[model samples]
Target: MVNKILISFFVRRLPEIRRSKGVTRKEIAKGVGITLGKYDKWEAGKVLPKSEDIARIASFYEMSVDEFLGLTEEESEAIKQKLIEDAERLSPEARKIVVDAMTDKQA
Candidate 1:
């Protein structure tokens, strides 16, 4: 499930990020492969995008998902470290899965 707080943060940050990139909403929508109306709704906070769509949009913005969601670099790094620490407590196979997913490389 999507975090409501993250979605709210993303909604508030979307326009700011777009403006900083000097791109229009339509451009972002097209780049991210979402409909312009859907992108409009996302910016308007009428609805949240699916997780995959959120990832796509972040990729389009050339940002990490946390960055795209308005987290500071320190905040993102802290979260990553926390996840890594937590994953260390999991079973070996699960830990490998988590590490691989995070690194996008063989664990």
Candidate 2:
């Protein structure tokens, strides 16, 4: 029951999130290594992403999959909130440097 609500909310909120983040759908598709049609389907609530794809999308937003799906507990949300605050304190250059370092580490 809860899962269904979360899934519905996630499907509805995804495109809003992307737009709020100022990233194009094409950019999100390329970043997630999915085709634009598939991304569009997910955004349109015509399909649900696989768990792995959900995780990938969550990572792109720098959020946990549970949080991205609006299924996070208060404590988990508080932690994410703190992290977001800290990130927001960084200068754009500093943020880029941190992002680049993380990307390099991932590679």
Candidate 3:
């Protein structure tokens, strides 16, 4: 249920991104090396694009696949909240040390 809703929302985002790029479905299809019908199906939520095709579309739109699908906001926030929770479970000094170690690439 949630998956379907997200996919539908993601499909809707495609056209908005395309218009921002000043391209139509035909233009994006040509840019991404696909059929206009197929691309239209994607935007219409009649078909979900595969990962590779989504990556290609994102590239064509000058955005990452994550951004293209609108995952950057909601998913990123979830991940950040998870990280904060994990950090809180650890000692404060330990948290800073972990961040520093990762930044320093000491591993």
Candidate 4:
């Protein structure tokens, strides 16, 4: 199993990947073989995907595990255009979290 890094590593990359796939949350959930709610939690950083599941998601997005975890922003951005799309789907509360993150403000 990959040693878990900060949970944010994977969480931060989700929006980018979503942007790249041209997929909706429903489609991403379906592609990942999980429920939309669960997948949303994963993307929203409320939960972390198991190591293997992370790998699977990386593969589904045609990226490396490192890329999926936001370790490589340039490549990740190129591959994760769909991630920004999903960011819009986050709930109001979730958007606050994202906003705080953007402003370097901690909740």
Candidate 5:
């Protein structure tokens, strides 16, 4: 028989990450399909959401959880590069909008 273990790390960057992306707590709560108070708890490091919620937030930010937590700079850059490459396949107008939005958030 084989045994497997699962480990999870919770880093509270939700507040900062949401702010950096110009997203309000309410918006994140709605997007994550959770109550605002629950989201607030998650952001304040008072609690952790389900793994599904973590994945949903990462998807919303177009980043992996590790990248969202600022854990792996190089890996995060690789993810950004991949996203950029995928964005390049979009129509010029769409690409421009996405690029502009990305640029605006970083500013």
Candidate 6:
């Protein structure tokens, strides 16, 4: 299930990010492989995008999903910590993969 708070944040933040980046809705839609109408609905808060769409949009901005959703620094840190804690319980190989992925994303 999607969190309503995060959805609200995403709705509010997306256009701000786009405007700040000087990009048009049409550009974002084309870049993310979504229709302009769908992007319009998302920007207007008429509907939420699917998770895959959200990820694509974030990637288009070169940001993580959390960053795209306007999560505070503390919230982002907390999520990172939680992921690290969970990864600690995984097998060494699995932990390495998780760490590497995280590192690669940051880079």
Local distance difference test scores for all models:
0.72, 0.68, 0.67, 0.61, 0.62, 0.74
Please write out the lDDT profile of model 2 over residues 1-107, one tens digit for every residue: 76676568767788888988999999999988899999988887777775456657777887655556665466555644554455566777545543443343235
- State which candidate has the highest lDDT: 6
Question: lDDT per residue, candidate 6, 60-100, as tens digits?
Answer: 88777566766677786786677688778877765665565
The alpha-carbon deviation from the true structure for residue 26 of candidate 3, after best TM-score superposition, in angstroms, is 0.6
List model 5 lDDT by residue over 20-51, tens digit each: 89999999889867899988777655677644
| Model 4, runs deviating above 4 Å | 1-5, 70-107
Best by TM-score: 6
TM-score of each: 0.62, 0.59, 0.62, 0.54, 0.52, 0.63
Model 6 lDDT, residue 63, Cα: 77
Kindly report the root-mean-square deviation of model 2 from the true structure over all alpha carbons.
10.4
| Model 3, total clashes | 0
List CA RMSD, all candidates: 6.8, 10.4, 11.1, 14.5, 8.9, 6.1
| lDDT tens digits, residue span 1-107, model 3 | 96698577867788888888789889899998899999988888888875446656766776654566566566745644554466566666656543442233222
Residue 12 miss distance in model 4 (angstroms) = 2.2
Q: In candidate 1, what are the lDDT values of residues 20-99, reduced to their tens digit?
A: 99999999999988789999988888887754565567668767667566667677677668767877677776565445
Model 3, residue 58: distance off in Å is: 0.7
Weakest 10 consecutive residues of candidate 4 by summed lDDT: 98-107
For TM-score, candidate 3 versus 5, the one ahead is 3
Per TM-score, what order, best first?
A: 6, 3, 1, 2, 4, 5
Off by over 4 Å in 6: 1-7, 72-107
TM-score of candidate 2 versus the correct structure, residues matched by position = 0.59
